[model samples]
Target chain A: MEQQIVKVKNKRGVRVIPGFGLSMGITLAMLGTLVLIPLASIFISASQLSWEAFLDVVTSRQVVSGYVVSLSCAFFAALVNAVFGLMLAWVLVRYEFPGKRLMDGIIELPFALPTAVAGISLTYLYSDRGWIGALFAQAGIQIAYTRAGITIAMVFVGIPFVVRAVQPVLEKLDRQYEEAAEMLGAGRICTFFRVILPELFPALLAGFGLAFARGIGEYGSVVFIAGNIPNKTQIAPLLIMTKLEQYKYADATAIALVLLVISFLLMLFINSVQLYMQRFGRG
Target chain B: MAQKRQRTYQQDIVGDGILAVQKVREPHTEASGKGIRCGLIGICALFLFVMLVLPLAVVVINALRDGWAAYQEAVMDEYTVRALQLTLFTAVTAVAVNTVFGVFAAFLLSKFYFRGRQILAALIDIPFSISPVIAGLVFILTFGNVGWMGDFLKAHGIRIVFAVPGVVLATVFVTFPFVFRELFPVLNAQGKDEEEAAALMGAGWFTIFRKITFPHMKWALLYGVILCAARALGEFGAVSVISGHLRGKTNTLPLHVEILYNEFNTTAAFAVSSILVILAVLILIARTIVEWKKA
Candidate 1:
């Protein structure tokens, strides 16, 4: 029926697909309405503040500590996840054992599980009376409701990013370089350091960057576990939430703008690096 | 365009590289490290258990802490049911809107050529790198009281912030990229030759899409929707920011869990969480099956 309408408008030599205009128009409209506009609103609203005010909001004592806690926790999480997630990926890609499928599936638990769920569960698990917490309690080491708890939650969610990033790279890695390294009088450890590590370096960097960005933004999981004691375990994202809760719109946006810019740069850098590696890794 | 084609060529070469590696592979001293392999595998197991399994087991355990009666009481309560309804209602809505949008966007991106295409692609990807917390903040800034639309919306007496609409919008924003990302790569891989042929034969867009494009894109679309559903159901940060913590009103399951946990209603909190945890596990199963089938 629609084709019947388009048939009359069609030229003899040219074939027009129905709905191209409608589809493209709808796509662009939604893209603009849902994505571009709201994102742009951040900068536009943020611009409402004076430059000094913007600096003050982002550099306040509380905000500074938040930045410290968030950045340090995320940095630690990403650093740990990059090493351990690579190992997990290596195990999945380069080895076979019983329950391998189960292990592989479990690696994605963080991806599928709700952060709120992760938060509460991690809290319960590490709370003094909780199972894991009880163990740590015996050692006089507190895990839950601390910075360590926050880091643990960040690590939980960030690990999958690293594993997912590195798995395919490991699977497709050409073995020739390692063989050639061995032929050149290099030991296994030496060969890995010189040859295989370089190839995997880009993946590791991309994963770490992505994980760090995620950890910095992470709130749901971190909030439940973090004591949320102001300037202690409070993270930047949580600080923004607190500011928003107080109806400090400008301050919230100022902080969010900083985070937004940082995340955007990190994401952009990772994308370009990953794209380059995909194009040239094997070469 | 040339870059995308080059990436595909590289992918093919990498596939060939894998085969080449297999052909020339031989046992070496490094390959003979059975004990080390076991040790590595053991560490992986411990990591998985300590991280993934322990938390999951804890959720189940705490949910049933008071036995089946308490679990039932927690889950079947009016507020709990209401939270579930709100979560499902908005998640389904977000998924439907984004799925339609994702299809249209991916189709436009894969078929048509125009300026600013790269920008359009990058815009679709913006949500991924964005913090969920930031995502929530942006929406509130746009639609909250004293926001750009605040006056207009207030004049209309429509409440978005601290309401269901805000919750849905935030969920939509955060989960928007999943379907698009999933479908774009698949749709791009499937160029437009068949679509062009179908158009030439005088098929309507609906007919062409249903007959030709849908078959090729169905699995990818399904994959995208599943992922979108998983994310929509699990979204917390964005929804929490706008949801206002109104029990049985604005609260989704995640928010409900937060409320209960904070209230020291551990049983109820864990029970409500188990509902989502179950849903999440189901999503994981569906994803695994989808991946297995796709592979």
Candidate 2:
């Protein structure tokens, strides 16, 4: 048994594929140049600022407001997407309706559409004189150039993430559990909440995280509608741009580093939760 | 006593008959089910129409608000044409570079086992989470006037930041993961058994790839390429940062739209946007076809 184990280990070291060296070289080289080195530049530049100065730059009144606006709007947008996207995914999977295929196809429109174009078009649609905005205007509610407009733009870009994430999992879900719940005298709503929802929680969470992350980092679409109001509608990404435009590279890098760290932490949290859920589901 | 027992037995029979009738009516509950289904579908349709369809329609309507002559002039304007050329060039170059890298990276992750393999896989996804503005900013920090390579590049008379190369680099960075993300799953699912067998039979690496693996992944590769191209074409924030808004030089189509819109040239901006709208629609149609074929 010991000899066999040793032999297997030795054999494993000699990969049968001939291009391993070539593939690894290209992967590392390109990843270094395009991703790693460039990302490291943010840190390197940011390190120039002392901790106090970094704190001062990131925590100033305007910067803090940018974070507030970005976080709150992203949170609202992600929440809205979680509910609406689930509906769309459920409808697409369960129903045989007219234009179902068309609906399914266009879910990715946000992904394909340019952010700038979406920005302009959404800005136009929600502006006071625009078709949809005109109705809201009658109620004395302004959407364009406000937080409401920013949230809507975030929703537009984030719509696809949730729907796409939940779709395949929803499709693969076994109907036996649902039927069993029904047989046990559970109502439709009860079965959905107790059985179906538990099964969908992981996908839903993943979708929510992705949408939230996208919303936080989103720029082009939100910028046009945000009206660039300094203390109010300014998003964190736009703040970074504003700093870069002013040639304040150190300040820009400091803010970007903070945003990047937040994103990384969020990703790590989501990934670990997913890993845990998979293990629990298996057990 | 016998008459009372008979009456009780008759009542039991009547109760059972009524229960049977109810059981037979169970399937008719679909009437209410149909209503709920219609309502859900309606909500979805209305949501999509208000959120997505209307915005897209507005682009076309506003673009033509100034009539065909003006629309034609905006699209055919010298600067607009120049921006279009720059957009196409950046997209093509970025897609070409990333496609090559993607093939290599996907092969490395899926085909081989190594230490830190998972880390490598996760690292490729960094771009997705990073903001586009950061993406451009990173390049500036690396190659800008005050950057690490600034002295070297300047000494060599090489310009990257605020030039065409910077635009391409930023686009490439943002789009780096798309092709790899798409291709990895397909290749990983294909497994290495066939390649292993081919190698044992002394087939060359290129031969094994061409005859065995390439056929399986061609559709996925094309799908990835289309996605990459679509993204590369429309990238704004990243390109905007590094391009320095050099009119007729570094301005891509999306930046051009911003410039036109900012200048109160609403007609021209919408007209330019209409071109991207058309491109986006074409991409959508192409994506749908690829998805159908893949499935």
Candidate 3:
């Protein structure tokens, strides 16, 4: 038994502290109860419906519009977040100024604040009679209660993901590459594009994926700002919520299964891209 | 020196064109560098102000729009107080269970190698991407009257959906990954040295953990718990589905805000929001302190 223990240790590296069984038991039990089985319930329940029923729920006009609004707004917001968040990460990592610490701390407010609070604040700020909305109204622009408003809410919540994701990568990056390129007579912009951006692209992509995924599932943050008009600004998550409220449990799960499948695929795609980029960078 | 020669060569190259006269006249590019830096910083500052600071200011401003008497009235009202209690109850329940399970999962993944570990990690992150509305549906499908286990739970006289227990379960499902994600990297980075050392000294597993790993993980555990609490407290989407919107009963703070807002009671909605805003600010302050201390 002692010899077997030693061999096991050799194979998997040393881990002398005992009770792996105990920890694993606790972990698997809780995870199965809380996450695995519950998620599996969606598939199980969804399967109870016939093919026609499933198709009917998923292909409904309202559901289709919800998918479009959610994806487009999330896509646009993530794109916006990618640009501004990259810049924000760059400034946070590369510069030192007064209140920089305060600014760094402020980026995470959206993560901590209630989505309802964020929603109301955005709506209040951009409503027709509100502060920023009044300015836009004069310029013949409508923001609140439209796709623009939904996208803005998404951008607010999504900013932290990109900023947080890219900030560490930026910090750990070696400045010598850019300096080398510069010494070879490349201008700042050229060196940035040729040397720095290639290294930052993977982190940027991962950030965009995260922001986009979160925006897809986002409800409370978008619902208030969206004006919640069906086939207009409504999102898939809100549609599910509305379905469940009306006790259309089958329809709710049907829509959920679709969203769940898409989100999983997106995550898998992002993970693969990140893995590929890591290998690409190493070479 | 090579540096001096290179500088003059650059000057010569610049002197070969219109840029040359400006470089020689300025004699130092420090001012231009400073100017560029200032411009970038200015833009970042303005962007953060417009995006983050202004929205935050709006919450507080509108929450207190009607002055102290009305603000106090809204806060002291029965529904608001009930919502606060329910929110706290659900969040505390979630944090407690998630912390224990999170630590266990973290320890298992980091301390031992096993098959399906990657699968387990990915499963934990399911919550991170799953929409909260969907999060609620899965639970309802498991526990609601028309649910798969509905007959079983009813036979056992246990109510989950549309009750406080349902709210707790949904919160747990949504915030499940927060503590685990926070602790997993920290524990992995810590390695198993201290635990192994204690084991060699004839210490038991629990003793080794209590003496060594817990001390090392204390701050991270606290940070995780804080984040979990903030998320649970602020959760609107998941809680709304299971809450059933019973006034002074199932409604949490966020749901209460929605109820009031839908009723067109903007003043009360904003009033209740200020309290949640304070909670958010407190969480942010705690988070900042932790990060600052880490530095």
Candidate 4:
């Protein structure tokens, strides 16, 4: 037993900590219970219906429209957040103006604010006769109770993901690289384009993926602003809830299964990019 | 010599072409004096202010309206209070469980290298990407009376769906990654030297953990707890499906807000949502400070 322990230690490199196996077993068990088993059963329940039935449920007009709205808004919101969040993170990390720390703290407000509050607040801000909404109305721009409203709510929640993800990368990037470029007679814009952006590209992509993923799955914030109009403003998650409430378990599971595939594929794509970046290291 | 050369080079630029020159030399100057950069910062400041601060200000203003007796009545009503309690209770329990499970998982993943460990590590993040609505449905399919485990749970009279336990379960699923995400990198970076030192000092595992590991993990754990709490309180997708929206029973604050909004009680919805918004803001501020401290 002692020799076996020594062999295990040799294989591990680090000395074997006591209880590691026990903890591993417990961890796997917990993950299986809370995550894997539950997720698998979604597919299982979904599979109970015939493939034709599954297709019909998932591809229903309202459900399809919900998907269109969710994916399009999430995509647009994530793109907007990436562009603007990068700029915001750049300002926070590279500048030393008054209220900088306060500004930094405010960047995470979306993460902390409950989605319901975020949704309602956005609605309040953009609803006709409301502060910003009245101004938009004067400009003939309708936001509240429309796709624009959904996108706005999504942007409100999604910005923090990009800012938080990109901030550290920006902060840790050696200023020496950009400074060296400046010393080589490269202009500021050229230096940013050539030196700074390339290094930040992978992190920015990761942030975009995260923000997009969150937006796709988002329900709480969008529902208030969406007006929950079927075949129009309704989101995919809300559709799933509708099916469930209607006691169509198989239908709900099938719709969920479709969403699962899309979200999983998108996340997998992002993860692959992240892995490539890790392997290549800040190129 | 490099510093002197760089400064003089910047000065030479100031003498050469003002616009391009100032832009090139901007990095060496006091950050405040960077003209276009300051304008860029101003734009960023405005965006964050309008998106985050203004929405929150509206919530607070609505919450603090002293003479809005109807709104106050809505916020403090029996249904409202019960919903808030349910929300808090479920969130606290879920976060407490998540912390324990997340720490153990993080420790196992960080301290030990095993086959499939990387796979397990990646799998923890699925909940983050997985639609919460899907997550909620899975729970229903797993623990609802007709679900796989539902029969067993029903036999034992242990209700999982449409109850507080259902809310806790879904909250756990959604917030599961926070503690692990926070701690895993910290543990991996810090390594096990202090733990080893404690072990060599004749400290048992529990003693070593309590004295050594816990101190390092406390702040991360607290941050994770706050995040989990915020997620739990705000989670609408999963909780709404599982809660069945029993007015004074299973309804959480988020669900309450939804229900009130559906009822067209806009003022009440804002009032209830504002309290959660304040909690979220406080938690975010705390997380930012802790993160800044770590930096």
Candidate 5:
């Protein structure tokens, strides 16, 4: 019916697919109901408070610490995933070894594994009496119930994003430029630094941004491991839950507002970056 | 383009060089010669094993320590059994509902044309960026006491914030995107040519969908459904907030594990966690296979 009604366009057309008008309308409605309305309500509820009260709630010592821990851990974890996840992607794309399939499979373990279960497992494995924790404990290196534990959990959850994002780029990459560099007598390291890294830069940033976003809101995994030591190891998500549990509704909303705002801005920036990359990426 | 070309070139050289090295490296000192590739593979496996496998193995070992007796005891307990049943029931319902709604949304996004398309596309990712816990909070603020719709619903006694209904709602929120994300790309790549051809041959929408479209979407749909199921079963933060964690009422398996762990019943926690681990492993295996086939 569509083909019969609509004339065929030239190959170099404005759109990739037809029916853009209808699809976009339906997409708008779905997004409105599922996302926009609820998010709008969060901000509205947040606006109910006076500016001073909002400031007080967001600036409390515990709240400030929570923000610090959550943000710093998210940043560092994403950085770590960016660095190592690229390596993992490179290995998968460049090498053929036994258990290659297994490595690929395990890369996504964090996605299917329940955050709570992962947290419990991490706590069990890294607690003072647990296996690795015993070694860390003896060396005066804390893991579980500490900032380090939070970072570990964040990294675990965030690694998959980087790997998934970078893998396809590595696979689709053409081989001419690096060969030319090598043919020009460039060292292996120099060839990599000069010829390859720039192309991956956009993808790397996008992946890092995604990982950072994911790490911020992480709860189930971080909660158990962080020990929720208020003002110390407590992340913002936990702080929000704690506030709610304690019947501090106003404070809870305020803290949640802070997280929501930060996450919203962060995501907006990332989305723009991704859009920029997607545009430049094709060239 | 330069980067892509360079990356591939480097990779080919390195990969081929390593293979060549493996063949030519003498027997003596061969281990050191194969160090880079071998060490890289070994390190990746070790990281996966320590992080992904060990805790899961510990749970399984602990659960089976007393053999079938312990497994049976845990599974047969009234609270444990009830929680398990409710979790399964809710997960199934959530995934099914999300699948229908998700396919519609994906179909619309993939097939239609309209205004606000870019904005709408961005909104699908809201659930992804927002915490599940925060999603629950959003629902509560919209439907709970003092919520925007609370007064009208409370008058009708149609509670939605503190029962199984709320759990299902939260689960739906988290899992809604799974099917849509999976199906959108498939739909984009396949296009509507064949469906239009079927329509030209006098097929109805349902016929075209059932015979022409679903076949293409089947594997992706299955993949999405499985991922959604895994998430629904293991959902803790969102469901816990809205469900009130009412032991037999809202306590999911993950919550049950937490309760047991807090009670210091490590065995029970491990036992329940082991079940989830098995489910996760199955999902992981299925996802891996599907992805490999796609690749």
Candidate 6:
């Protein structure tokens, strides 16, 4: 019995802490029931549709337009976030100012606040009678119930991803690089563009990808602001809801399957990039 | 010696000239640097104000736009009250279940080297990337009338889709990764040497965890719980899909806000939203405290 136990240990390597079976059992059981099985149902339901029918559902004009609005709005929003998020992170990390901690704390507000609240509040704020919206109304640019409104909603939800992603990397950044660049006659703009930005690129890209992916998948915040105009401001997730509401289960599954596949690929890419970055150190 | 002395004298004068030039430029550069700093800070402040702070303020202002009496009436409405109760129940249940699963998964992944560990970690993160609407959709497809187990569930007299169980299930799915993600890094950093040492001394796994691992994980676990609970409390899209708009029966706070807003009961919607905003603030405060403690 002792020899058999030793052999088992030798083969699998030593695991001194007990409860492997118990922990693995509970983890897999919960993960399977709660996450995997339900996710698989999407695939199973989608598979029930023939390839041609699946293509037809996903490629239909309204659905195609939904994809366009979602992807474009998310793209622009993430782009905005990448720029502003870097600025916020830079301000938080490099400068000492009043209310810095408060600023830091509220960077997570979007994450903590309910999307429904954000949706209603944003819609109100940017509506024509509201303060900011009234200003834009005079400028002859409508925001609420438009593509711009949808983009703003996306930006709000995606803000935390980039800020949180880049903050740590920025904080850990070596100051010596800045000093060296300055000593080498690099001006402030040149130093930032050439020296600091390169180092922050990987983290910035990771944040951008996360924010973009999130913006694409965002629903509650955008739906109210999006105005749900078919073939115009309608987002992909909202279309799924529309299909579900109409009891078109197969159609909903097909759209969801497309989204799932895209998001999965994006996540896989981000994870691999992160893994590579960790191995190679900061770029 | 005289030639070297002459060269030293020239070098000293040249150095003095350079110093004088830099001294002349110092004030100007310093002023610009300060200006740049203030500009950057101002932009960040303005953006965050517009994006985050302003929307929060709007909720409060609009909620009170109808006067205190009206705000109170909306909040005290029977359906709103029921929705609040249901929201609390779902948040608590989801947090409790995820907390247990988080601990087990964290321990298993951090302590033991096993096959398919990477795949498991990735699988855990799937919920985070997937849309909440899809999360709800998957559940409906699994438990709705035409689902795979639909007939079996009907035979058993079980109703999950468009019911409270479906609501809870969707909440659980979306918040699944939060606790595990939070706990894993802390556990992995602490490593297994201490746990292994305790084990070799004839301590049981539970005892070792209580005396050793649990101490290190307490703050992270709390942080995770706060995040999970906050998310579970505010979840809208998933609950919205699964709840079937059965006001007073299935509406969570977020869904209640939606129903109110859509019905043009704008004041009522903002009032209920104020509750969630306050809860979010409280969670933010709790998260700040946990971060400080963890650090």
Q: Assess every candidate by TM-score.
A: 0.89, 0.93, 0.93, 0.91, 0.88, 0.93
Candidate 2 lDDT, B100-133, residue by residue in tens: 9989898888888899999999999999988888
Candidate 4 Cα outliers beyond 4 Å, as residue runs: A1-14, A280-283, B1-27, B30-33, B64-68, B197-202, B288-295
lDDT, candidate 2, residue A31? 94
Worst 10 residues of 1 chain B by lDDT: B23-32
Task: Name the better of 2 and 4 by DockQ.
Answer: 4
How high is the DockQ of candidate 4? 0.52
User: Can you tell me the CAPRI class of model 4?
Assistant: medium
> Model 6 over residues A171-220: C-alpha lDDT tens digits?
99998887766554555665676789878878998898889998989999
Task: State which docking tier applies to candidate 2.
Answer: acceptable
Q: Which ten residues in a row have the lowest lDDT in candidate 5 chain B?
A: B21-30
Give me the candidate number with maximum lDDT.
6
Over A22-91, each residue of candidate 4 has an lDDT whose tens digit, in order, gives: 7787788888888899888887777678988888877779989999999999999999999999999999
Measured by DockQ, the strongest candidate is: 3
Worst 10 residues of 5 chain A by lDDT: A10-19
Off by over 4 Å in 5: A1-34, A277-283, B1-34, B65-68, B196-203, B292-295
DockQ of 6: 0.50
Clashing pairs in 2: none
* Residue B64 local lDDT, model 2: 99
The DockQ-based CAPRI class assigned to model 3 is medium
Clashes of 1: 0
Please state the Cα-based DockQ of model 5 relative to the true two-chain complex: 0.41
Candidate 3 Cα deviation (angstroms), residue B184: 1.1
Could you give the TM-score of chain B for each candidate, in order?
0.87, 0.90, 0.88, 0.85, 0.83, 0.90
Q: Cα lDDT for residue B280, model 3?
A: 89
Residue B50 miss distance in model 5 (angstroms): 2.2
Encode model 1's per-residue lDDT on B1-295: one tens digit a residue: 8788566656645554554454345435444467778888898889889988999999999899899999999999999999999999988999999999999988888776667889888888788788898888887888887679889999999999899999999999998888888888887888876787778778889898899777878888888998899889989999998888898899999988999999999989999999998998898888888888887
Q: For candidate 4, lDDT tens digit of each residue in B60-138?
A: 7766665578667877899999998998898888888888888888888877777898899889988999777887888
Better of 4 and 6 by TM-score: 6
